[model samples]
Target: MPTEPEPQRPPVGPAPARHELDAERLRAALVRGADPDAFYRRLDVVTETASTNADLLAAARDPGTDRRVLLAEFQHGGRGRHSRGWAGVPRAQVIVSVLLRMPGIDLADLGWLPLLAGTATVDAIRSVTGVDAELKWPNDVLVGGRKVAGILAEVAGTHPEPVVVVGIGLNVSLTEDELPVPTATSLALAGATDLDRTALAEALLRELARRWQQWYVAGWDVTGPAAAYRERCGTLGRRVRAVLPGDTELHGVAADIDEQGRIVITPDDGGEPIAVSAGDITHLRPVP
Candidate 1:
């Protein structure tokens, strides 16, 4: 079988003045009109890194830490689902990783974290940039049928409390020529008039904080989040193909997102609806 080609990296050049995120301004904006003790209570922006998720996961956990959001201007080793590389020009994307600590709960419930991040991103993009964003099942955020962002969740700790790092990479101002692939798009290309990474960051964190607080207080209930996610999801009701683990493939129509956060697909084979624990899903268009 032929291997898939690696995604191209954005050509390395001097970081443009128009793309820099002001660390101070972003922190201030996040704190305004928000509870001081919110889950997304801390913020850090760096110039470069291998991956924000890796750095925060490897760092010594601070006992006083709440949810800390880490952003990097450029990432050389960033990854998405299935370990696919994600890269972009310095300061041209809203690359962030948030460390979330949840109370002890059933392991299956942890799946909601990634979905929460996806829904939050869609709402944030729509709220901040006026772009109509939608969530593809699992981890993708799409605008006008092009992928604009991806979510990756990594487990950090799970003994005393379940801790997960949710990483989100969004193309902010990449030109047409800079997209890693033809299917990818940036806010600029998606008709977002304002490309301020700071504003987008503030909006994203605020949404995450608000929704996360509700989930935490409710003991990780999926009722509200699941319903909201289904509404924002573009995958439901679409004919699709999902590549499950062990390279098995299933053709189906995305039917629903169950309480455990897995996608329930009605198989094309006339079998019963099955909830996939995890998979790489591709939405298939109807035959005209």
Candidate 2:
């Protein structure tokens, strides 16, 4: 009897490429052809952190600490506005915090910091990934009405000088199953061809530095920033329901954003427009 023929093996394809972010590569990209003293005094990249904001806040207590940046690959205890827990898969997001000491900046103008951050994020995402990212009021960065990034601004210290810690978390390569929520999205899900973390990070920091300089030089004037923000904000002119702090909800049409960076909503029942400083806004579609 003839021996049985050996079974054939299936063809092998190329291995999936893994993209990793390097601390030194990011630092070099951030400082290349830029003024380090004027922008980042020190840049640090950590493997994991509970919260970059918390870490920077602690560092802010020392008055001698200069403007520093902290980037985390994974955050076990990261948080957003209202202390909401925020986290993403390791090496699949941009988790960074910027610590700045504003010596004579007025407290009132500080409200625009989050908006400034949101605008910078939007610009960076658009330029890097070609995604039309927009702002969802205060600090949520949305792409096609889905949240892709979030910003949190916290006051770190106030004695010698006011130190502000602004943290941004952007989803880069998360797949559908990896999204934090149904309403959340990532650059990969949003059809971004390029997911280069180093390029994206450099673009974000460059835009932030440019906008921050303008805002700082203008003494935190919201005229320019507000206009730019309004243009990129998708919440305005849409019907929305704002969930206030006390569990009360306000349903109205988002009319405009005030100078103070508050959302001005005109009630559907002919009531006076309400300026909401802080709240969660949900866009409501109109009935046919």
lDDT of 1 by residue, 1-288 (tens): 222243453444432346678888777667533546545567889889999999878752654554788999899899988898877688789999998878766777888988999989999999889999999998799887789999999988887777888999999888777889888988877767888898898888889888888887887778989999999999999888899999999888899999988899999879999999888888786534
CA-lDDT, candidates in order: 0.83, 0.84
Model 2, span 1-288: residue lDDT tens = 121232232233322233667777767656433444547777888889899989998998788775688988888899988988967688889999999887777778788888998999999999999999999998899887788999999998777667899999999887767778878888877778798877888789889989988887887778989998999999998888899999998888899999999999998788999999999898887533
The residue ranges of model 2 lying beyond 4 angstroms of the native Cα positions read 1-18, 32-38
Model 1, clash count? 0
Per-model C-alpha RMSD: 4.4, 10.2
- Which ranges in model 1 have alpha carbons more than 4 Å from their true place? 1-17, 31-38, 60-63
Clashing pairs in 2: none
